[model samples]
Target: MALSKVFVSLMLLISLISTVSSTGVIGGKALPPKKPPVAVAPAYAPIYSPAPSPIAVPPTPAASPPVYAPVRRLIAVQGVVYGKPCSDWGHDTLMHASPLPGAEVRLVCHGKPKENPLKIMATTDKNGYFFILATKKVSEYGAQKRCRVFLQSAPTNSKFIHSTHMNGGLSGAYLRYTKPAKPLLFALYTVGPFAYEPLPSVCHQKV
Candidate 1:
């Protein structure tokens, strides 16, 4: 009608500019070609290890304990008992070394026998000489103090006599001491001239 109403208002202004350039709006504010900003990763943040080598490690010395040797402890003893003539076997003669008064001596303390009660006998003084002084504390110094020197009984019962610890008077004679480089309150033992013989098989049993 006017040119077909001006060509129908120029096709409704080109269909509203093609519906706002296919909806990427424009003045309503959406242009659409930006997308590049999504990085976000820090919930603890702390990982960097490499620095330790100045060089130094020396610590090891612990082992030294054992040096034992100082135990010499025996206290006293001294002796002599005589009377010879069984053909003077242990010859300590001065005309058969006499001195054997009354006899009977016994200081047998082998391992503390009953706490040292060997009845403590010690006779022989007319110069037969005998001494024993130790009421407690003996044995120590290579320790094996079977302390003996027995010649118990026999100044003379004369059945042809016998005593060098007479196997019959019960074997004895082991008390020896001498250690003095410095240490003494006792310990000077000199046992024996312990003798007695006369039994040539009792003169062959009165042949």
Candidate 2:
């Protein structure tokens, strides 16, 4: 009986030693449990923004037609020339005066400042009538105040010389009236009846 009890105690001691070795325990302390492998998080895909839309533009407008101004008409200046054959011819009335045929008249006009004056010339017919067409438009020279008419020359063979009558032979004559000429395209401006007179010796010879 004593030998069997000793054999049983020895077997129990061997089993306890095997259990401690398998559990990884030593010096009467228990070992910690084994940790599981850590799981890795998946990487996120890169986010991309969409491209912007293009801007819209308006269409251009159509071109317009050109405009033009009306054209101006020409103007005609008309007048008559007279003569005093003798010095005894009175200055009061034009009855003793005769038509100075083949006489020349000049028209002078001052327009804008610093610009050259406008000059025109005309000759008298057998009736001593004269007319000059303005080279430029009437609007260019302005009103009649800007223009004057003067006697330029007379027949050299005639006994009469230039005389200051009706402000035409010596000084300048202003426009007197305006009328419409024939053909309806011309504007007639009447000026004066300029005159010429003989020298004192011619009248003395008759005396």
Candidate 3:
């Protein structure tokens, strides 16, 4: 009986060892092999973002006015007058002529046909010079082309007589040497040194 009891104890101990080695359990709980520490991923920063842009616009233009200039006007006419001797006729008589102080001269401008011509008159001063301020009529004539200076009359009491020598006593003298006159608002046109002649009888007497 002692031998049988010992044999039963030995059998139970061997059975326990076989169960522990096959299942790897100590107290009925499983001990699985420790899986390599689960490889963990690292943390990272968030991606960057930018804001939006604005739209563009165009500009407007300005308006302006036109400008004009003023026109030049005609103002005055001037000249000198002289008296020639009978012998000085039909010859260059400038040096032989003398100033006719109180002589009368006329400005004649022929306008459109059938219309009365524009006429202006002036007298010689002490130095035989004459300056005629333009009238509204003369300015309207626009230019000096159609105009002329003629000897109208000489001092009646003087020995000088109206003669058609050198276009001074009868014919017309043209305008020349344009210049500026006083008051800065007008133009001055110069004419010739018109002349008159002494009587033929007077010339013979002097001879």
For each candidate in turn, the TM-score is: 0.29, 0.59, 0.60
| lDDT of each residue in 38-114, candidate 2, tens digit only | 88898899888887787777777788877777555566778888887664454644678888888889888887789
Q: Model 1 over residues 42-138: C-alpha lDDT tens digits? A: 6897877878876887777777788798665555666767666555644445365567776767776645436643446777777777786756545
What is the lDDT of every predicted structure here? 0.63, 0.76, 0.75
Q: Tell how far residue 101 is off in model 3, in angstroms.
A: 1.0
lDDT of 3 at 46: 72
lDDT of 3 by residue, 1-207 (tens): 999999999998898888888888868987787679877788689776765566555665566666766666665778877887777864666777888888888888877889898888999998899998767656524556777888888877988875554644466887764745444566678788677777777877877
Which pairs in model 1 have colliding backbones?
Answer: none
Any runs in candidate 3 off by more than 4 Å, and if so which? 1-72, 167-169, 181-183
RMSD of 3: 9.8
